[model samples]
Target: MNPTRHAVSLGLRRGWTEFVLSLRSPQDQGFYLFMGVGTLAYLWFNRDTELEGTGLLLPTFALPSILGALIAFGVVIGPAYALAMEREDGTLLRHKALPHGMQGYVTGQLLYHSLGLLPLLLVILVPSFLLFDDVMSNGAAGWATVAWVLVLGLLATLPLGMIIGSVVPSVQKVGTWGMLPIITLSAISGIFFPIQAMWGWLQAVAQVFPIYWIGLGMRSAFLPDAAVTVELGDSWRTGTTVLVLAAWAVFGMLVTPRVLRRMARRQSGSQVQQAKEAALQWVR
Candidate 1:
């Protein structure tokens, strides 16, 4: 087998192993439970409320949007924290010492993060379907739309996470640089409510980012065609959604490799030691 291909194969296995381990970890299990319960509770509490014009209940309106937000949140922050922590813990350094190591490392991250979404989505979606009515409109066609939106959203946003991880100084900084911004974006991305209610300028700003588009695509997938009246200009804007997400995907493909290479070039034993010391202090 080719060296690069061999490395990528190993990385794929590594990702699968990590996912299995995460499933067995009590902390991860608790996290899944907590998020699923919390989201379901919110939707349940507001289940009877109807949107002013859409005639859809709160859960039906919010479920797909929340799923989209979760997708963006998980893909972006997962790799950011992982890369930062791995960089400090000597994982990246170890890989750097091997030939074609970066290729393998990137592959592992992509696979791991992609697989990571499965449990997250399942934890929320399976129960959601049971508890909510009319949560999926258009049946199989809606599911097909969901599949494409997820694929495009992942392609557009995963690279941004990798870039953030490569650039941040330490794992500690991920909260400020990664978590904060993502949370803010989620709030403004129409996950909790319709973006139509926001100020015009805020809506414009939200449109510039992938989070809003992802949520929009997801809403289009789950909501009935009549619900489009609640969206901006009473249309789904499907063309714009595809165009914007594709642009981000192209940009990430162009930029992430160069950023990773630059970050790898700077890794040194001394920095890893300092990171270890800092981590120890944090633990204490």
Candidate 2:
């Protein structure tokens, strides 16, 4: 088979299998519960505490702040770090023995881990309807825009997560180091705070990251006449964050499989002793 066909068939088949097996793992359950509670708590308190002024719609602060945290901190970093750990403990070796080996295994692992976000999304959405007593009022256009934003956000952040998973040297250090990126990205993305308040250069710096666009998209979903549009020019509305994220996704698409394969081979052949052989294979 050609390389393209081989990768796709393997990736799809692997994603499905990994997704299923992941659900059976007890740790997956706890992950969902913890993330779900966080999303719910943020949505519930958001209206009363931070968004009381907006009235009848999700405030600019709510979606970006809340969803940003849910997406970046938990959905993005959690799986990436978890996968990193699994690779270290020799669990990934067992995966490499399976059909389609590490590529499918890692892809599936990401999708499987991201499943926690589904319930978390629902948890946050429900409270917005019940407690906030408000709707986006953006109608079909608004909802469609929001969905695309969310999808783009997912696609963009996912690759970065994979890259982080692949590049990070050890799972043990993921918490110590990984959490910093998650938290810092969350802040810069303007998920928990306003980026516009920062200096122009700081805002420019924030623009270099994905959190900014993701937060803007979330805010646009609720804010009427927010002038949110995607362009590639110097305009702030050019969806730079989403585009950067898409680039990362492409980067992830290329890098993650190679990294997984290398790790898998190292795992199979004894990583420390066979590191050079595995790394060479990965580059090829």
Please give, for residues 114-223, the per-residue lDDT of candidate 1 as tens digits.
Answer: 88888889989999999989999988989999999999999999999999999999998999999999999899888898998899998988999999999999999999
lDDT of each: 0.92, 0.62
| Model 1 lDDT, full chain set | 0.92
Q: Which ten residues in a row have the lowest lDDT in candidate 1?
A: 10-19
Instruction: Give lDDT for model 2.
Output: 0.62
Predicted model with the maximum TM-score:
1
Instruction: For residues 1-284, write the lDDT of model 2, one tens digit per residue.
Output: 67545655676666667666656778766666666666557555555553333333333346545675566555568667767766765567766676655655665666665665665577666655665543464778867876777777777677667667766776656766677777776766566555655677777777776676766766666555533322123243635556676885677678766766665665654663354455556679
**Candidate that scores best on lDDT:** 1
